[model samples]
Target: MMGQLYSVGRNIEAKVMKFVSKALIVSLMGASLLAGAAHAATTDKKIALSNNYAGNSWRQAMLKSFESVGKKAVADKVVAKVDVFTTADRAVPTQAAQIQNLILQRYNAIVLNASSPSALNGAVRQACSAGIIVVSFDSIVTEPCAWRITVDYNAMGRQQVAELARLQPKGGNLLEIRGLAGTSTDAKIHGGITEGLKNYPQFKVVRSVTGDWDQTTAQKNISAVLPSLPPIVGVVSQGGDGYGAAQAFAAARKPRPTIMLGNRQDELAWWQQQKQDGYRTWSASISPGISSFAFWVAQQILDGKPVPKDITIPYLAFTQENFEAELKAIPKGGVASKDYTQAGAIAIITKK
Candidate 1:
């Protein structure tokens, strides 16, 4: 009986030792797992950015916004490296080549500021085929690319016309300084303006000319229109051309028109100059903060968050009510920064 008791005691002790060992092993594993997670939280992620137009202030601001946000994303362990490519002016072909280079480098992801919608399709396809996640900002690629970050350019145009209608109840003559001919923003903005004017049969589009995003060309167009017998009441122009219009107005010695639809960066400066000049007729603007919008889209791409294939940011319309405070807050270039944080990379659809 004593021997049986000894055997039973040994079996119980063995069971206790096994349980203690298993528990200790589990506790150590849990501790190691927590440490690994902490390390991951601080890890950096790398990204590549390619821009089509660096000459324009909007494009410059867009690039700056991307770099700043990308740095923040890395510090937060969202991303590490950022490879940037910039092409002079609006050169689509050069931009496509840059995309190929980024793909060759095997970047984790790519962000593009496309010039023409259809021109960059091949490059975008190549990037996706190479397994690099793609994001387009400011302008949509003509072909179906991953995601597009933009503002409601259509609404901007519509709003410009609506404001003009309010100012000139009796319809007046209008002139347009169009941006690059093939861009969707140009098309949408013009289309919206067309539709908005249909409401008033008296409002007529006297001339529509291509500025090619050139200020000189815009000034020339405005100069030509200034000599026309019918006095001009309003002008709707693409970015980088507002100052040119102002110059034309000054040269012509005509009171600044009743309405001027200026770009985002030029708004505050333009408004201040108008005020200083004591020009009350100089008012109305639609500003789409493209740089800040681009950063927001990049963050959405990084975190596995789902978003529409195409997204449009809201455009702000400046009026007398808010122009003063708005101008005061606006930066020199009217560029704004966006913040990025770690989130799951959204599963973007890539078609080859």
Candidate 2:
């Protein structure tokens, strides 16, 4: 009777142990599934890059940087996919239609270089209403709901002219090589240039021409107008035309003025060459890799990170002392001193 009782107790104990073991295994499986789901949520985001124009090398470089960073994000499984679309006509309506299509396609986020600041407000609002993230950089949007990633163009323009004034205290005729007319950046920069130049009365803007932020266009325009203008002692340029301006000076067999360099690699190379010939100048620009910064911002937002609506990335300036190092870091035909990582982008956020 004692042996039977002991055997019954042992059988009951074994059954309890088996039951507990099964319960533990089921609990672990549930935990694993939860973890997997969390990871999938983190990685399964779709990002789209909406470019307003690809008219210049800077824009081209910006798009390339975006693509490179997007590929890296995909490889790291941080984002599932990246889609790129550009409006060839560079019209606000065209870009608005593109954004509408992106909304219809259900992109998780859009990284945009807007054609106009206020023109895309409605389209951006629509995207936001649909629970999509929108982050604009470079040529940005005026939508209050969407995030903006950019440098202070006003400051940039002011600084460029300031630098030119420093180089030429008794500033002579300054040919202002402007970017695309009517764009917010161009207007801001132009305003800054005008404001900053007020302190230097000797400096005169002998001519102003729209380069459209294209080296070839700038070259053609400068070439056409070079014969008509007085000898320019300095140039206030909104980038993309410094090299072309230099080329025009060279072609005209005229002495190169105290030209402010844009952060273009070719410009840096030219600067280095000119430096060898006892010429000295400095350069500053809003990096073309700003698109990549915008990309990272979009990623952070999609990952549920709280990013500020307005993030100002400061302009990068390279002087004679560090131009060589800066030039070496960039790829052939790329911007100088650009940072493209998530941390790099995050480091520049002025608010929140």
TM-score of each: 0.75, 0.81
Residue 236 in candidate 1, Cα distance off native in Å: 2.3
Root-mean-square deviation of each candidate, in angstroms?
A: 12.2, 11.7
Residue lDDT tens for model 2, 1-352:
2212222233454344543454455456774333222223347789999998786667777888889898987876668898889988789999999999999999999999888889899999999999999999887888899998778888988887778877887778999999987777789889999999897888989899988777889999999999888899998888868999999988998888988878888999998888887787888888888888899889777755568888887787888788988888777887764648865765665244
- RMSD to the native, candidate 2? 11.7
lDDT of each: 0.62, 0.81
List residue ranges in candidate 1 displaced over 4 A: 1-44, 264-267, 276-292, 329-352
Model 2 compared with the native: what TM-score? 0.81
lDDT of 1: 0.62
What shift in Å separates residue 108 of candidate 1 from its native position after superposition? 1.5
